[model samples]
Target: MKLSDYAKSQGISYRTAWHWWKQGLLKGHQLPNGTIIIDVDSSNHIRETACIYVRVPSVEDQDDLDRQANRLTEIALAKGYGVKRVVKEVASGLNDHRKQLISLLKNADYTVLMIANKDHLTLFGSDYLIILLDQLGKKVEIIEDINNQSEDLVPEFMAALRIFSQKIYGKSMTKLQVSHLLSEFQKQFAPEEH
Candidate 1:
């Protein structure tokens, strides 16, 4: 089929198909006439294998990651995906080059990479992660913790920031300290109001 027809068949826009083609993510080939042909059967090998990646910045949180990841595993397994293994990161998500994450994306065995939240994956440039996952024919699954105090995005984000900061600094933050931290985080992450 032609590229536009193939994109229509795949339920994606022609531009998206073209972007995938440029990224080498679409399983397709170019003919001598400069037309693209998609290998409809090329992606059948992508079985849903779950590989959980947990981020806990301190020894205090390290002990709890297993329980959290196990809970995530239960959800994945319930969905019929085979559990691969849980990978951990002890560094700040603001840092771009994480060893375990880099290695895992290079790996082609798993169809899914599960994490507690997008924040647990990276503090910024999450689209980059998604694009990389797409190229590798994998996906990221986020399991929100049910026990969390708030369901609202801003409060939950601030709470997560507090937890990571405590682990990074190796000390419990005072209420006032958290207030200051939240202020700075908002300044950096959220646009200033005035």
Candidate 2:
């Protein structure tokens, strides 16, 4: 396909496509007449379109979220994975109903889902998602495989316990009671200050 058509298909400007071609991020060749032809099939075989997914546990981590997205974008670009989109969201990894994530999963534009960490996508069942995406001819690329890294798991545990307690206690357990219980639980496990 012509470079212009390829750029149009990718929803990018001609100049950007030309730049990518020059940077060797795109596979193609220029003819004697200065017309560039893109080897779409070859490029698709070598590099898949990527959708960078970035998330934070809360709004307070907005800066971290931007940093995460930027880092993933750099990685994706450096890998020559044509980045189709970067979806950023402020939501708990334990939350199952993240709107942007759900939407991204349903969208078929990209073949690769790039993320900073597994927990950035979800705290649990990330393998299931990866399997499903694989079944759908899509894949996930984790920049930092920190799955076994030592980190604070108290907040996630408390969130899960709170959810289960709410479900079990129904309307009997008030929000205040849950919060109090979680607070105490956190205090017990929290690291001591110097």
lDDT of 2 by residue, 66-158 (tens): 788888877876776667889998777789999999999999989899988787789999999999999999989888846523442544455
Positional deviation of 58 in candidate 2, in angstroms?
0.2
The root-mean-square deviation over C-alpha atoms between each candidate and the true structure, in angstroms, is 14.7, 4.9
Model 1 TM-score on a 0 to 1 scale:
0.52
List, residue by residue over 42-146, the lDDT tens digit for candidate 1.
Answer: 461224777888876445456657877778866875565656667877665665677998887777777888888776777678768878887878888778675
Question: How accurate locally, in lDDT, is each candidate?
Answer: 0.69, 0.79
Whole-model lDDT, model 1? 0.69
